[model samples]
Target: MENFRPTKRSKLELAAPVSHKNEQFWILDGNTVLEVGGVLFKLHRSRLVDQSIFFSHLLDERNVQMDGVVVKSDENGIVYHLSNTTPKDLEALLQLDKNPMAYYLVPPPFPVLAAIIRAATALRFDTYRAFAVKHLENAWSSSVTDLTTERKSNAVEVVVLARTCGINSVLKRAFYEMVRVAGYGLGDGEFDADNGERPQEISRADERRLERMREHLISAWLQVAVRVDRTFICPNQPKEPTAGTESRSSTLPKCPSLYSKRDAWERRVHDSGLYAEYKFDPFCGLQALIDIKWDEDEGWCSDCVHAKREVWRTMRQRTWERIEVWMGLDK
Candidate 1:
């Protein structure tokens, strides 16, 4: 982090009297002044300290005899330089403090929301942090699609933001949502397609988390596939031979024919190139299998396809339920 130093006043300026003028409507009768990204804000120290532990500790360290360790003194009073925070972010935080109800009524855009979360986390503003998380959760849950337009674009950044702010629940959901839509392998260029703007790059540590999640999801799919192989039955199988047909029973029973149908279904899944597709794209694979059309001429019965689709649906639902646990986020 780079340090932003305030302008130094000459020794002659120390003897000059200081006068204050109201700049913004929210200035009020504030004793502490702050400069963020070249914009000045006149706000009360007590109000800020009360809301944020970080602010409380920071202000407590300043010497009151020196007018609370002035960073810059002018006609607008003394100002403290707040490094790395933008004017917009500081304004949003102050607005939330002044009128929280109004702020929550109309949520900010994603970029502004990200800035607010970052500033709130750094300043240790617990109330604002919780408020942001609640809004994010609402945004995520309101859409029924695998991933909403906003979520598709911002999910990656939100994962990083949630981890930084210590919002574990959001982090887990965001990660799961990303995997659900984007699949196992995501290239850097594909990230920008969700929104026109380029997304913030995730750190290598976060990248590893995504990789681990993809591995778990793939394992879950493979397990479901194994279960399907063991339990699926061919609908075309004939009933067992009735009574004793004697010489007519010399012919092979129908059990081999039933097994052959099952084998053919499995072979078609591989031969049609779906098996390879499923390895890279699990959700799409499940969808493709669900929509499969069986032809009588191809030795596949409609009843068999229907039964297989039902099994796939059940497995998919079960896999969804266990994803959070597999990712170590159930707690």
Candidate 2:
């Protein structure tokens, strides 16, 4: 209810010297005081110094002073002003010790987790940042299959998180996954696919990129689907009829007409609404196409089926490679 009293750290130090000490963090016997957003927090110097490189060096005449970590001292010992951070964010960082297990066992929600990570990064708290990052890595695994099981809702948040935290490893995948949120995919198995759930909000620049990528991604998927290359020979089928009707006669029935395999594949695509579903999820959709044993549909034969599957697989990889560029992440 008063005003920020300044000492000599910066012209911008916003520590309130009178009428305020954060009720939650003021410790009676604490050695150091940190003031952020006009509220003071009295805490142990060792708790911060031991866990953070920035804090370790901060308890000195020449401090990194980073962005906050400024201000005056009194009966509470050396007061450091952390005006650059929010009181809530500072509390989240300090509370890590009170609830260390929460970071590992049940992890905080993204909002809480983000506060911790952001504060940690600013304060050079490596352990705290790593703890939060581990949870993100788990959610955005390199394996797309594992990622599929995650809520598509999470991908957009991760895109922002990855960029904020400087976690480049997860950025591409997160952006790729976000395509589904923009109405790219008709549906996926694990996520809320009724098109009803609200996707996380992202920057307008990202929204524009997604719109452009959506058009290109659908085109890439169609490239593979429309090819439907031909091969008369069914490799898995023996050329010579061994014993009974078990031979090529029953299996091949007859060599499919020029484009019968293509037609049959198209029919199935139309039936499955696969085009709609896969437009946004090119990598997964392409893989799904590859995994199928096409011969079963219209007697295309194992050789032809495997050959087409190989083409689909190649397209899957190609799609994956282009995703970064498509999403504008390459820049």
Evaluated with TM-score, which candidate comes out highest?
A: 2
Can you write out model 1's per-residue Cα lDDT over 1-331, one digit (the tens) per residue?
9999999989999865443333552466777777665566777888889998767876776633322223666666666766746566667676677777875588878766777778787777888978977887766552223532232457777776777767766665566667655542244654454446555556666677677767876776665443336455666555466677444334533333455655665766667777665663455567666766654444556666677778777766666566566666677
- Tens digits of per-residue lDDT for model 2, 116-162: 87788777889888887787777666555554524455566676667
- List where candidate 1 sits over 4 angstroms from the true fold: 1-29, 56-76, 103-106, 141-151, 177-199, 216-231, 234-281, 284-310, 321-331
True-structure RMSD, every candidate:
8.9, 8.1
Measured by lDDT, the strongest candidate is: 2
lDDT of each: 0.64, 0.69
lDDT of 2: 0.69
Error of 2 at 178 (Å): 1.8
Which residue pairs collide, candidate 1? none
How many Å off is the CA of 243 in candidate 2?
Answer: 28
Worst 10 residues of 1 by lDDT: 142-151
